[model samples]
Target: MKATIERATLLKSLSHVQSVVERRNTIPILSNVLIEASADGAIKLMATDLDLQIVESISAQVEQAGATTISAHTLFDIARKLPEGSQVLLHAAEGKMLIQAGRARFNLSTLPRDDFPVIAEGDLPTSFELPAETLKQIIDKTRFAISTEETRYYLNGIYFHVSDEGQPVLKAAATDGHRLARVTVPRPDGADGMPGIIIPRKCIGELRKLLDEVEGSVAVSLSASKIRFGLGSAILTSKLIDGTFPDYSRVIPTGNDKLLKIDPRSFEEGVDRVATIATEKTRAVKMALDRDKITLSVTSPENGTAAEEVSGAFQGEGFEIGFNARYLLDILGQIDSDLVELHLADAAAPTLIRENDRSPALYVLMPMRV
Candidate 1:
């Protein structure tokens, strides 16, 4: 197979597919990307790691129409280092692939295209289209809370299901038996009968990258075992985790007795400064909510203590709670509003956080036992 493609275009396509190729692999073909040159001068690149797969296509100049598999990382590096807009020539011969760009030439080992695994597209029971930005909103808000614990494999993904109100809802929840984060997106139309699916953490990561390039609408195809996302020039397919996510609705506190509103940035920065004195084990910073002001303080036996006051817009009944500083920052970073609202029942009850803008996003934090 022989084809000529622009260095930039080739590099961009390779960049998207190579990320799916693992660095270490037991199967020889899994490390390589399948490149096919069609008669119409279009080049396609595909790579997979058994469970996840990516395929992308770009325009190229084809001299001979055929297909070959070559190392994704190596080819990407070569194309990336080459001069911009330069024409790159690729040809496969004698179980080796050759690359020529400007004055530089490279010969890479090749694998048989037949050995590469392809995920079969099954007849999806449900299919829908939604804006890529909408999908991204659910992912970015909840992905951080996905648990890394292997024993509870089901909690390793964001759960997408219909909410109790019969609204289409997407939720991400994770717990190390300590803290939990839950984010939901209102269900779009055409997803009424869709069953809840646990999207793996890795799939969420890759989906974020794909959505960045997509705007209008992304076509979604789902089966019992797999999910496919088609974003114009690329296709992402991955196996869904087959397990049940815990009932996250119960964990949210409905009886939060105290409500405090403070500047999101001020609360974030105050926690950052005071937490420096917090014990490394607990990382707990105590918050004192008084009339029109919030005080953040942390005291460590060996490290001393630090305190900072952040003015608030309300003067509710004073309440104090201890929380992990890092956790507070993580949730606050996702809030785009200037003011953050914290609802508290007591130091023991979980605190509910929401932005003043009445956005759909809500975060619940379990206070650290300090």
Candidate 2:
């Protein structure tokens, strides 16, 4: 296979696929990208790590129609370091792939294209399309709460399902026992009968990259075991996690009657300032909500204590709760409104947080002992 592609175009395509290739692999071919050149003036690049696969196509001047596999990272690095606007030529011959750009040249080892594993495109029973911005919003709001612990594998991905409401709505949720984030958006057409699927954490990261700065619509396809996303010129396919997510609805607090309204930015800043004296082990911050003010304080036997008062409106009885400072900050960062509403029942009960904008997104936090 031989083709000539612009440096910028080649780098963009390689950047998208190379990230799917793991740095260490038991199979040599899995470490390389499959490059297929066709006489139709386009080249396809594919990379996979068994669990996730990315395929991208770029326009190129094809001199011959054939296919081969070359080290994905190596080729990406070579293309990235080449002079901007330079034309890159790739030629496969005699068990080696030749790469040339301007005065630079390098020979890379090649694996037979037949050895690369290709994920079969089975019949997808469910398919739909949604605006790219909508998908990005759902992912951004919930991904941070996904569990990194491998033991409870079910919590390692976002749980996606349609709500049981009479009106069609799509919901995405993630939880790690400490905090939970859930977001709901109007369901797109053709997505009514889609089953719940757990999209793995790594897959979400890669999919976000593809949707970054992308407008227009993204096509989604789902099966019982796998999920696929179609971006403009690229495609991502991932295997779904085979576990049941816990009943997240039971954990969300419904009886929290105390309502406290405060400026999110000021509250976040107050927590940050008081948390400076918090112990590194727990990073715990105590919040005391009174009639018209909320006090954020942190006390450590060895580091002393710090406190800051922020003005707020509170109803019902005043209460105090302890929470992880980092976790609280994370939840506050996702709020897009100037005012944040915290619904609380007591010191030990889970607190519900929502922005004033009423975007159908809510966060639940389990209190920590200070």
Model 1 per-residue lDDT tens digits across residues 1-370? 9999988889888988999999998888999999988989998899998888999989999999999999989899998899988999999877998999999999989988888899886777778787888888778777777888999999888877766555546444555445566666666666667778888888888889888888799998887778999998999999989998888878888877677888898789888888877777759889887888888888898888889998986545677889989888888888888888888888888888888534767888889765
Count of clashes, each model: 1, 0
What are the lDDT figures for the candidates, one per model?
0.83, 0.92
Native-structure RMSD, model 1:
1.8
Candidate 2 stretches with Cα past 4 Å from truth are none
Query: Alpha carbon lDDT of residue 286, candidate 2?
Result: 93
Predict model 2's lDDT versus the native.
0.92
Native-to-model Cα distance after best TM-score fit, residue 362 in candidate 2, in Å? 0.8
Candidate with maximal lDDT: 2
Off by over 4 Å in 1: 164-177, 313-316
Position 93, candidate 2: lDDT: 86
